[model samples]
Target chain A: MRDQPTGDQLLATARDLLREDVLPTLSGSQRHNALMIANAMSIAMRQLQSGDEPERRELAALGKILPLPESHGLALQQALTEANRALCRLIREGRADSGQTRDQVRALLLETTRQRVAISNPKYLG
Target chain B: MMEETLRQALAAFIAKETGAAEARISEAKLLTGGAVQENWKVQVDITGGAYAGVLDAVIRTDSASGGVAVSHNRAEEYALLKAAFAAGVTVPEPLWLCADKAVIGRPFFVMLCIAGTAAGHLLVKDARYGGDRVQLAERLGMELARIHSIRPPRPDLAFLEWYEEAPALHSVGRFRRYLDSHAIPHPALEWGLRWLERNAPPRGDIVLSHRDFRTGNYMVDENGLTGILDWEFAGWSDPLEDIGWFCAKCWRFGAKGREAGGIGEREDFYRGYEKISGRRLDRQLVHYWEVMAHAAWAIIAIQQAERHVSGEETSLMLALTGHIAPELEYEILTMTEPV
Candidate 1:
């Protein structure tokens, strides 16, 4: 429904401007600030490209062991946050100490964490 | 004239401390890029005093937003520096401590300035600085052993709280307490901390640890290390904690091949440490502490990010640091298998 230049495309273009043009003109702390801005913009662009699929996948994974409420009215980010907290509670109660539940909890954590790292810093996954 | 007035007050204070007839401050410049402390480089010329010389000095004090509660205050840090200096550690000479806030709007301490760069990003890649990497690492280890030589039950360092519980558990409790205040939960941190609590080694080899003894915290000239800097995070803990923190993959700054702080082989550093401490280290136990090191860094990264997120401080660097936690969390998970 949106226009041709999407959020991700706009950020990618802006970051290109910063890295290609503005970065060469700066020095010292100003250069460092510009680099950080470019890096942050790149991260935003990557996240936008990935969209909400990762969070949805994480929520479905969390629902495997922990019972999910049918038709729970919440946004994707909020739902993931609440579900993750519940999983943390389960982990602290020693549910993830041994047996199949432990394996399941670790799998979800690893899968979801890898997805997050991929978004934040994909080179880390490599 | 306001700057002149402050300079006069500072010069008068220096004169009294150095027993000089008059101390003339030629230059007083504030250094940048410290969140917790403010360092002012003051050039003082002493006239008719026991310490009569042209001195390049640095005066350190708390920032406008006073230092975080965890670090030592100005006087305590000065005492720590003196203790390290006395113990044969390479450190700047602690000259004088001013407790009277009237002198500089905050209590401060003065020390002789040393020349060197402490930036990890540069030190790791550029061999021109820090000389031979192997000797630099060995020297760092020896310096650490000297710092660990100072034991507890001292009236001077009485400000450091002694803990009956294992240092590992103490850190876990602290991480948990801090996470409780955070808006969102950190499941990976909780899971990793659980592993730490379960596998914590008994409190036996307790020694003073330079909690932030990584590549960036210390300064090194082209020849070798000039001085071990940033004594704020020093505390009593297992000596291996420092070793583990030093060797953690996260501290390596992209040079993951070289283990000893991305500078040299771990064996050389350990050899220097063993020579000084007269004790062998358990290399296996250091693995657990390495995982803990990642967890500790992740916690600190969160703290930095929160400082920016809460509007307490607006810093792009701080915001970026928060993003580093996932990689650390991944490391923690990789190291601590559920089996």
Candidate 2:
């Protein structure tokens, strides 16, 4: 088991300190840099909190769209990349132009992008 | 901004180029915010020549680190600036181009500097600069119309590629090709691309487009616009492409309520364009290009982040740029969602 004050906790604490303390002391590009660092830390914390659950969910979602051998052994990240890449081909081929497929693809893309935004910048989701 | 040897070479080159007894660089300060280009603000004093006075200029050259494949080199950018200047576009006057790399270790050009700030975030909020927002928007529109006046078939700009596909479709194809080569898939971006393909504006009057036209790309003083800048991405494309790029929500810099580049209403900008081009803008067509603009920005963001991800450059800014893609993707998704 991981110890207390894990990676996310550390990042959260650091980001709070940077935003509250360091940012006020900085100006110009230094201020911009501090804000960007704080933003990166927040993103890291969000990703850590969410863990690999988003990727796992993404993989399962991709499995529904792309045809593949049942239970074909592949790692989570690799399988996700492969499946999403295939979907890219399908979309480009106009297979998702207008129909159930188009609607499903749109929904999937929206959901997946929302998931990414959830980690990268949740405020954008508004 | 310049080493001793480079400064000496530049002085010699200026002296020779202007038929001056001597040219001395009083100051050379590297300006910020051009990721691909190095822009050095240079102040020069010339003696015994037609240009025999203190002059302010910008020395522009490619960063040795290289840039996107689609952008033109320093020489091409210089030529584009000349064309824009000739077209009466409010651009920094292109003074001279030096193709000899041995002089500065890279091809560089000199242009008369315009006084203003070009930071989008500042321009949007700070009334201290950029003058009256409505007039600025109108002027920007007029400037864009003037830029679009420079049509193809010119011998000098023969370097620009002539494309058969509608500009929108061409852009979508380019993005797809990039995604195909990218290490990972971007289904959100692809979704935007598909919508663009379905609704691309038809191939129409081809004109020179300031492909990177946006709030940050131009400069404005307390009174008004000083000049349009950044022509590295200049190319032949449908005129609406530039308009879309200019008015895209992504370019608004958080001043979403204002529209027309976060400065004025859309009609004011369009009216300015109409005053110059004597043509009306099709709102529907402009919307399509706005969607394309988001997709284009997302691609550029991904490429920048890749520069950091692949270790070609270690930069916090580049890594942060990667994070912006999701926001852009969200914008794309919202814009392309069926009514």
- The TM-scores, chain A only, for the candidates as listed are 0.94, 0.92
Q: Write the per-residue lDDT of candidate 1 for residues A2-119, one digit (tens) a residue.
A: 9979999999999999999999999998999999999899889999999988888888988997986552788877877778878888887888999999999999889888887987
TM per candidate comes to 0.97, 0.96
The weakest ten consecutive residues by lDDT in model 1 chain B span B1-10
Tell me the chain A TM-score of model 2: 0.92
Task: Write candidate 2's Cα lDDT for B76-186 as tens digits.
Answer: 999999999999999999998999888888888999989988999998888788888788889999999999999878999989988888888888888999888899898
**Model 1 over residues B1-339: C-alpha lDDT tens digits?**
227887888889989987899998898888753768888888899897877989899988876677777888889899899999999999999999998888878888999999999999999999988998888888888999999998887788888878988888888888888887888788988899989988988878677788998989899889989999999988888888899999999999999989999888899899889989998878988899899999999999999999899998898899999999999999999999735
Residue pairs in clash, model 2:
none
Query: What's candidate 1's DockQ score?
Result: 0.82
User: Which regions of candidate 2 fall more than 4 Å away from where they truly are?
Assistant: A69-72, B33-35
Worst 10 residues of 1 chain A by lDDT: A68-77
Q: Individual DockQ of the candidates? A: 0.82, 0.81
Q: Across residues A19-103, which tens digit of lDDT does each residue of candidate 2 receive?
A: 9988899998899988988998999999999988888887777777778434467777778888888888788789988898888
